[model samples]
Target: MYIRSAAAVSPQASFEALFTGAAGYQGEQLSCIEPDYTSYIDPKLIRRMSRIIKMGTAAAVESLKAAGLEQPEAIITGTAYGCLADTDAFLSRLVEFKEELLSPTAFIQSTHNTVAGQIALLLKCHRHNNTFVHKGFSFESALLEARTMMGENEITTALVGGVDEIIPASHALLRRFGLYRANGDSLRLVNEPAKGTMAGEGAAFFVVDTQQSANSLARLDALQTWYKPSTPNRVADGINALLAEQGIEWKDIDLIVAGRNGDTGDDALYDLFKKDIPETSFKQYCGEYPTATAFGLWLASHILHEQRVPGVEGLKPRRILLYNHYQQTHHAAYLLSAC
Candidate 1:
């Protein structure tokens, strides 16, 4: 599997949001500020779109356009909270109407698969479709599915994405549970506390194909998700295992794109066990999102194309490592070694 194209809309100036350079977001909680929906989506359909659908579809469409693909063989997406705006809206309506006169629009859009469904509707595609919402590993789940389908005889040009929208209720709830930063403060506020990872929301999508298209920045090297990261060495071992399997080692990698933010600067998940390996961190600019790593993959592609790394906070390395440690122990890592 390989990524032909990748696009994202996040709190920071991702995609066309770039002005001076892609920078970090220091808000209380990381949120994808969203791009101009009108530019990528039709005005007629714009008003009805919930944030999740609008952002998700927009990223997916840009990826397709970038890949020079009109239609994809499959649509796979990952989101911890899919169509949250619609979910919150529907619930609000249910409360107001006592659940009797509630419209089905919000309810239908709230499903985890709504993004995939809406993309299919607009693109007139009825191919294999799937969505994953496995907490922080949601996008990884979607990638897993795409990897399998890409190996199939008839499948090619698959669309994969990850998205999450910030909702007041859920954000508050997460704060209460210590899952998010209170008052949307910079996560570095608790960096020394060393127990909390920042809360973030975003949507990232890509056009993938089984065959190595000339347009592809780099092939899908491999993806790995872990239930528990007990030690720094353990996380490094996990990364090494994936690299070794591909007959590639850490030294051969041009860079390691990591999901590391200042908040978890010391979390063995961000910095590597081995200091010798070069790395690049982007969450400070893109903010923290479950799918933020998707952009890490995009940055990998960008570096491969532009032969330069975007301005990321703190770290000063050339090679990128897209390593993400979601929650305290549960983590996911993607090695975006240059092709």
Candidate 2:
């Protein structure tokens, strides 16, 4: 499959800003620097939309516009925590109001599918809409499904995305659980000798098709995900299997973009798999989120399209490998080639 166009809204403002060093990592929890919603959505509709909804819809719209498509034939999204702000609000209301006279808006928008459904409603698209919420593998699952649907001729073109939001309550909870680093330089997260990493939230969308286009950014050569590999050798075997299936070797991979979130345990797994290959990390820029690999995918696609590699030491890349794992169980790899 080919990515016709891509767009993302994150704490770094925009992907271009992120690559150009205009955006800097802030702290432990990075929130998206949202775009002007009025430009992409009507003022009236924007009032009722939650942050996640607005982020998802704006990204989808921008991607479609860049691809010159009025609407996609299919819409797919992956979200680890969907509409969390609204979910929190609804729960708070349920408790405060004792389940009486509760407003339905928050409840209606709290579901995992709400983002996907809202995008479809905005585009008036009625075909092949879905959302995945499988924890860290959520985005990978969505991409895998979209690729399969395209290969099966279920749809010629699709809009795919991953979105998540961080609320104060949830952030506090995660901090208590030692999932977020309390203090550290987010840019040097990989070097931090700490037990936790920063948290972040963002939305990224891509317009993809089975056929290549004049505006194609990159080609999706292959994607594979594994669960609980059990050992570093098992992870290595998975990587080798994917390379074999794609008819490429480690030498063919010009760069390896890894998901190192500064967590000692999780980064150790990547350390075992990377093994002397030219490598870099994206979590330092995007922070740690379940579907943050979507941001890694966006970064990989941009590097291939622009033919430039930033923040990494070594040769310029032509073929890039994106590897991400969450909780040391869900591991995913995607191969992208310059188009």
Per-residue alpha-carbon lDDT of model 1 for 1-339, expressed as tens digits? 777888877666654344355444444566676778888888898878888899888988888899999889889998887787788889999999997988788888888899888889889998988888887788888888888776666687789998888788877777686554443334343333344446666777888887777777766667788876666678778778877887876677656666665544435545454556666565655556566667667667667655665543443333345677665455777655444
Q: State the local distance difference test value for candidate 1.
A: 0.71
Per-residue error at 26 for model 2, in Å? 4.3
Best by lDDT: 2
Candidate 2 wrong stretches, greater than 4 Å: 313-315
State the C-alpha lDDT per candidate.
0.71, 0.87
Model 1 CA deviation exceeding 4 Å by range: 15-19, 181-198, 229-232, 264-266, 312-320
Error of 2 at 61 (Å): 0.6
In candidate 1, position 293 carries an lDDT of 68
TM-scores for the candidates = 0.87, 0.96
Candidate 1: residue 48 Cα off by (Å): 1.8
Q: Which residue pairs clash within candidate 2? A: none
- lDDT at residue 295 of model 2 (Cα atoms): 89
